[model samples]
Target: MLRRSRCRWVFVCILLTVLLRLAPLKSDSDPTTQLIGDVDNTQSFGVNPISLILVQKLGYQSACNSCSHRDLGFTGRVAGKWYSVWADTLWAAPGVTDPELDTPGFHGMVRSSVSLLTDDPLRVVDLNLNDDWPVPHQQPFIPFNEDWGESSRTAFGGASLCEVDAGSATAAVFILVNAFEPDLVGAGVAKVQVINGTPTVTQRFGPKGYWWDATTTPHYGDKISYRDERSDYIYIWGGPPNRYTGWLEGGYIYLVRVKAADVFDLCKYEYWWGHQQGWKPEVLTTFTTETAALWGTGQGQIVWNDYYDCYILVHLGIAGVTLYMRTAKSLEGPWTPDLEIYSTTPIDGGLVYAGVAHPYLDPSGKSLVVSFTNNNRIEVVKVWFK
Candidate 1:
């Protein structure tokens, strides 16, 4: 009887241990209860010190009489040997005064490159598609077919570019935020590839009545992407419909991912359905009963911080006056609550928005080159997180 009792106790303890290991981790603060079950399930707590300094407002001194632009949102990416940025809502006229804000001939987007030299990293120059670098000129490169229905009649508000592989490869996946187009009412994807000796762009519009199935509605505005070395997959994070889109729904965000090689294949997409369901082949549609959010909603970018040994998210407030930061152990995370990092008064007649962190600009990850739109121009700052 004594031996039997001991054996029974041992069996019960073993069962309990297995159950605890299988249960999902929960957080009181994170509404989604982010389930980090993979190998990189590490968490960091407490406050991390961060500092922000005004680097310089990026200026464009253009001689191209056909280079007028809009309230620009700067989303930078490392394409080939250069840092390329998607400059949204461009016009071919000499200049666009405030009266021309609603002008009709606004081409959707253009590509610009920032000089990657250590001397001046914020210099915006024209992109040389042949060599895949920035030249000493200010004329932006129009790499897409503006006459196409997908590229025409649309103005982008935000963009995130994920290079398929690190290095001189010119192939990448671009996610863009469509601003107030009656037909293209949300986000879209563009596959950028260098064919033969020139660059070529192929794009697909996002959830809309005419373009794609409107059931799977995911707002790519303020969206960001990161390549996980462990999983060898690039994760795209996006959320809460832009209130400007006339979307009065709840503010929630989700994540989707695809292998680097399969980025251009929409059929290979996988949606994050939390710990129980894990990743599903089907997307998170509008009517899905269960929804998950990636640390709430805001316009920002996520970068891995060597100092914090975690992922850091630097984003702007809804009003765009204050900038905030959040830290998480993993990409799919129980992220820390918003910690106000910087706040400043907006310039006269200018609102601050479209803030994102450029990691390639600061290779050491000690300081970040952050950019945002202020006074209808893109301004940059240096952010330090110790």
Candidate 2:
């Protein structure tokens, strides 16, 4: 039953990808699936009307000639300005799928798109546009944790895509990363390496490499509230995206568990409450710092304060909050706010969206405390560090 289920999901994905690349499906009766990103865009700016039809569609020419056609993004001009889709372009519902289907719609010149596929066990679409600017196509996207060997193909083989999750390595180790989707590489994937490992660099999960399969789903040791003084991994912790039901309807923080000694190629970021496919995973706590931070700082950031050596969550805006004090000795902490942190410029920052946190030892030695500023609002929470 397990094998049969896996095959069904896998085949469905293949069908979706095939139907997407093959333009103009035969009929609207079959109800083919579409794989478009949330945003659509044309390079030209200030145009009267943006055109999605002009975007180049690669008709799986490779599946017949060389290798199979995989990960694709669009780059074209409309008026004159320059804009681009992400490294992976979004798939639109086939014309037959829905001529009226306009979602994943165009967003003027900043046209972006997302490719939606269901995780066999229903995995989350871990996307990191936490920042406004999209990552460059030339930049290396290394995958920190994914199911490499579960598929019939050898490890790192039979890949449809790959990406590097470089969260912890960047803030933690300061390793300068540089990689690219190999040239002439079919079913393309890139080779990632740490410039320095005296201490492991930022650990991250990206959707650029390795196809997802069963068996490699469950992972142990993921941290829920990220706070580490000397840990070497940084993870994008959260359950699947657009969860329409259950506790995760509003989204929740996922525990990205990785050993200080684990390589970027082997780290794992799992749902904090564990996987509950087709059903919404429970959010251990209602404190969704970033997404729920509706104060309007965008996605937000999770940072480890090198100065304080504790976690600082700067989420909302430039002058929001800072980690000041924790009221209790436990995670059920009624943390006290340091109102002065509002408007304090972040010493160093990024989209601290639950990726990294600075951990501190509580006086009790029984609890762990970490602090961060959401935008400018300072927050300090006690968590279990050991």
Choose the strongest candidate by lDDT.
1
Worst 10-residue lDDT window for candidate 1 reads: 129-138
RMSD of 1: 11.1
Residue 200 lDDT, candidate 1, scale 0-100: 40
The residue-by-residue lDDT of candidate 1 on 169-198, one tens digit each, is 444444443434543355545555544423
- The prediction achieving the highest TM-score against the true structure is 1
lDDT of predicted model 2: 0.25
Every model: Cα RMSD to truth: 11.1, 22.9
Off by over 4 Å in 2: 1-191, 194-227, 232-235, 245-248, 264-271, 274-298, 306-309, 317-386
Give the clashing pairs for model 1.
none
What are the lDDT figures for the candidates, one per model?
0.51, 0.25
Model 2, 116-150: lDDT tens per residue? 22111111122222222322111112223325312
